[model samples]
Target: MFTIATWNINSIRLRAGLVTRLLTEEAPDILCLQECKSPVDRMPLQLFADMGYRWAVARGQRGYNGVAILSRLPIEDAGDRDHAALGHARHVAARLPGGVVVHNLYVPAGGDTPDRTVNEKFGQKLDFLTDMRDAFRAEPPRRSILVGDLNIAPREDDVWSHRQLLKVVSHTPVEVAHLSDAMQAGDWVDITRQDIPTGPLFSWWSYRNRDWTLSDRGRRLDHIWASRDIAAAGHASRILRPVRGWDQPSDHVPVLASFDLPV
Candidate 1:
């Protein structure tokens, strides 16, 4: 059994303490991070190593678009694919001892506008997801777990006010359609939703909302997905919503799942 968690740390350097806190407390066997915002050399690997996560694979640039996987169990560095040629360190993959591949990604937020014609970032987001679809179609994923701040809510219940957010960037129909295409191409199962199945689940609460609990306006931007071959192994899915309430917390919270891998 392996417990894995994924979170958009916002900035690993700034929130290293939060990582340590989670390591000391929840102690997931593997932790995938997006938006690390720091180079690999600058990551606190030694610190994480001290807390039992001695292995890691990462891709990063200065102050932007980074992803990493830290593991207490032995892990091998799998390739990093810059999907859509975004030229950003948006993805990194790692292989676990049992050959399960784990992908960590930070998809573009697509700016404020929904129209790709008017917004360059929005265009990039669509292209990135299109590339994801093409890549997965070319080489379908097997025994893989993908997690990240994918930046789209995708489902009606994923956002606080689905009707209100239908025009919003994360919940927009176009964005959701693109994300769904990628999922379909890879034949990935939404493990988190599979276990829970229903309800207003969310992993991201905006910083704009003061007293976020009262407003309860949040989105399920972070996700945990498994290739159909291993989908049955995924269980105990949980969103660490209380982590968002921690002091100096990231706007995003952690999403977790445990896997009972076949021997």
Candidate 2:
């Protein structure tokens, strides 16, 4: 069996210790991290290498958006999406020894203001989704797993309070529709949704909230999607909530999924 995990570490430099802890505890075959916020050269590659994981490939920006995939097994060709218009560090893909390909993504977070007319960031977010849909329609990967911080809560049950967060940035109708279109274009299946068909499931909590536990205003911004061919093999999917209470936790927690496939 192979396990894959995705976590938005917020900043690899700041969270290196936490990452080391996670690598030792979870021991996933492959770990995809987003929001690394450090250049590849500056990232602690040797640390993960010493922990039995090889730094396969990483796409990063200076003190901002960044992504990396660490693997225990050998990785073949890997690359990032050419979202030239937005030019954001949002995507990366790697091919394993087997036919399986893994995609790591960090979708644009539309600002609090949803009006694209006023918010350029919001417009960029929409355009990014559109580009993704077009790209996936052109070439869809087979036997693949796409995982990351999608930044959009696609379903009503994905948020703690859909009624209250309807106007929120992540759950807005426009963002949801665009995300749905992208999923349809890729013909991707939400593996977690397939397993847990009901109730509010969230992977993100607000650091602004004084009492996040009591307020409980969370959104499911992260996801793991699989191609139809390998969707049935997805099992043991879970969110590591306890990690949120760690010494210095990220607002987002890790989401893990295991498949009965060789690494």
Candidate 3:
């Protein structure tokens, strides 16, 4: 069996300790991290190496965007995505052993406003998804798992207050449609959705809320998706919610998925 975990660490430099803790606790065969917010040189490579993992990173401007994949097995041929016109550091993909490819993504978080015409960030977010759709349509990966902070709650049960958040950026119709377009383009299946096809699943909580547990205005911004060929092999998908309460935790929590693979 092989396990893969994905999280938006917010900032690798600031959350190195938490990352170390996660690595020690979960020991996933592969961990795909997004929103690293540090340059490749600044990342604590030696630390993870000491913990018995090899890592590769594709980075953007420091203090802005970055992504990395850490593996107990070997990883190779890492590359970044060109989001057509948006041009953000939003994606990275690496090939692992056994012909499985992993794509780590940090989809653009549209601005608070729902109206794309008034919110340039919202427009950019849509465009980014469009580009992703086009790219996958051109060249789709086989036996792949795509995981990350997709920044969209594409289901009614994915949020605490779906009715209230309908007009919100992440749950807006435009964003949902774009996300669906990307999924359709790649013919990818949401592994988590396939398993837990029902109510109230969330992976993100607001730091501003004093009583996040009580308010529960959370959203499922993070996800794991698999190509149709390998979708049947996926199991034991979970969200590490307890980590959200960790000291100095990120607003986003880790989502984990496991696969049965030949050794």
Query: 121, model 3: CA deviation in Å?
Result: 0.7
Per-candidate TM-scores read 0.99, 0.97, 0.97
Q: Mark the regions of model 1 whose C-alpha exceeds 4 Å error after superposition.
A: none
Residue 205 C-alpha lDDT in model 3 = 97
List the candidates ranked by TM-score, beginning with the highest.
Answer: 1, 2, 3
Clashing pairs in 3: none
Clashing pairs in 1: none
lDDT of 2 by residue, 119-187 (tens): 988888898889889988999858999999999998998998888888889999999999999899999
Worst 10 residues of 3 by lDDT: 53-62
Worst 10 residues of 2 by lDDT: 76-85
**Candidate closest to the true structure, highest lDDT:** 1
Off by over 4 Å in 2: none
Model 1 per-residue lDDT at 35: 95
lDDT of each structure?
0.94, 0.88, 0.87
lDDT of 3 by residue, 99-177 (tens): 8888999888988887778988887888889988998899885888999999999999998887888898899888899
Query: What are the per-model C-alpha RMSD values against the true structure?
Result: 0.8, 1.1, 1.2
lDDT of 3: 0.87
Clashes of each: 0, 0, 0
The model with the greatest TM-score is 1
